[model samples]
Target: MISLARKSILHEWRRFAPAIFAIAFSGILLVIQAALAVGIFSTVAVYIEKSDAELWVGFPGTPSIDQGRYIPNRVESFVRMHPDVARTEPFSWAGGVWRSRPGMGDVSVVLAGIDSRPGSLTFAHAVTPVLRARLAMPGAVLVDIADRDKLGVGIGSSAEINGRKVHVVGFTQGLRGMGSVNIISSLATARYLDPGLQSADEVAYYLVKLRPGADAAKVQQALSPKGSNIRYEAWTAKDFASRTTHYWLFESGMGTAFGLSSLIAVCVAIVITSQTLMAAVAASIREFATLRALGAPTSHLRGVVLQQALWVGVAGLVIAGILSALVLWLAKLAHIPIALSVPVTAGCAFLVLCVAVLSGIAALSQLSKADPAALLR
Candidate 1:
């Protein structure tokens, strides 16, 4: 059956080309849509994801990192007191107006105050040691390379955050915020920029690093004991990152919007692909009738149709993978956040194959027109 299906597709390449193209294009849309949606929401957890901290201690019921409020600086002491803890650092956050220069409009920005000391765990993955060293300079700040134009500043350029002058010392990549631009600075700079965070006893959160071979979950439980008098909450790095992203993606309603758009794309793809396959099948009705007249069973012909659909799906998926890669590269060049995970790519390929199979089923109606009597006409 597969051999017959392959031969038929090869013999009628022109007839099936549209079906293949439709499947390929549809695959591209679905993959790209899923990538963009995931990438955008993943940014909501950038701080937690980009850091090497084993645990995060923050205000009770802090749904997400951005939503975190002041928790007592003593949270750091409590976290550090754990026997398995290696070190702890205070992570502060503030929102401020960025004034790049005269004539440039003010932009809303979120300031992340991180420990600039050597071996700091906060953003250790994204912010290099040199960048962290630069941040140690008072009033020096770092911004994502992608946001240079938006903030109207570059290295050596001076900007004002909440009317306090800040110098751009360096740039980092993949640190862009979901909505507002993200600015990285030392704790002192962030405090200076936002008067509200100047209270030395209060910080937004505390980052914890545990000794090698120590269990993070155990330490988290120790730091944030279960009791009615709990002052703060402790979260494993992985759990907090997931919570942060989940809050923005689902709790904030963005996931519903993205899901609807993706569903629409799938529907559009199914409709176009099914119509194309049906037409291709219809065009080959005479050949099918000839086979039927030669004692070929209808089930065999149906298998041939399904096999053809599978081949079309495979071909289209190959083309879509190539096209999606190109699109993702272009998006990167444009500074758009788009990422594709292995699972996501595999799921998308499965969906494309499912679409192809469904289209083949829809095209089965054309088989009814393959009557041997039609040959007499």
Candidate 2:
């Protein structure tokens, strides 16, 4: 049955091209939009996702990691007491005003205080060992390569954070923040830059690394202090990352915009795909009628049409994959944050197939024109 369908498509390639293109276009839109959406929201949790910490300890009721407040510095000692914990590191977050170049005014920036020790947990994925070594120098900071122009600074360029002089020692890739430029520096520098907010006795959060083979969830639960004296909360790394992404994605109302745009993409794809498939079916009505006249089952004819749709979908998906790859490559070169995880890519493929099947079902009504007597006309 599929071979017959393939033969039909191959024989009249021009007639089926539009339907295939429509499906491919739809697939590209869905996949690219999904990548952008995930990428944008993922920035909100970069601190969590890019780190090697197994658990995050922060103030109770912290809405998101970016909004973290100072929890007692003593919380580090409490977390370190856990048998599964290998180490705990203090992390600091505070808003700062970046003094840009002459024409550019002050820019809002986030001061990220991370340990510059050899194997710091924070930003372990994005920050290299060499950059960590540079950060160990006082008044040295790191900026995302993507944010250099926005903050009006480059490698070795001097700038001021909260009126304190600092120089960009290096640049990190894929460390851009959602709202503010991120200026990464050592823990002591962060405290020096924002002494009022980041004091010696307090830190915005604590990053916890567990011993090998320790279950993060179990350790997170065990470290979470119970009762009223609980001034802080502990979350497994995955859970904390999800929490931060969810806050920006759903709670912040951006998800609605993304959802609406995706719906529109699907609707457009379905409309165009169904119309093109209907036209193709209409063009082949006489062939269908001849098959029916030859005693072919109506069910068999329907199956052929459905199989054709499936083939179109497969072709379209392959094309879309190629196109999406090219687009992503270009986006990377342009320093755009767009990511496609395995699940997201798979979901898009499933959606494309569903659209193709639905278009085929809609085109099935055109089969009614396949009247045996129509051949006489």
lDDT, each prediction: 0.89, 0.90
Candidate 2 residue-wise lDDT, 1-377, digit = tens: 67889999999989889989989988999998999899989988989989999899999888789888898877888888888999988899988999956788999999999999988899999899999999989999999999987887778899888898999999999988887888899998998999577458699999999999999989988988789877999999899889988898889999889888988988888889889889999999999999999998889999999999999999999999999999989988888889889999999999999999999998999998899998887
Clash count, one per candidate: 0, 0
lDDT, residue 321, candidate 2: 96
Q: Which 10-residue span in candidate 2 carries the lowest summed lDDT?
A: 194-203
Instruction: Kindly list the per-residue Cα lDDT of model 1 for residues 182-218, writing each as its tens digit.
Output: 9999987888788886486678988888899999987
Q: Clashing residue pairs, candidate 1?
A: none
State the lDDT at 265 in candidate 1: 76
Candidate 1 deviant stretches above 4 angstroms: none
Judged by whole-model lDDT over C-alpha atoms, candidate 2 comes out at 0.90
lDDT of 2 at 55: 93
The TM-score of candidate 2 is 0.94
Task: Give the least accurate 10-residue stretch of model 1, judged by summed lDDT.
Answer: 72-81
* Native-to-model Cα distance after best TM-score fit, residue 139 in candidate 1, in Å: 1.2
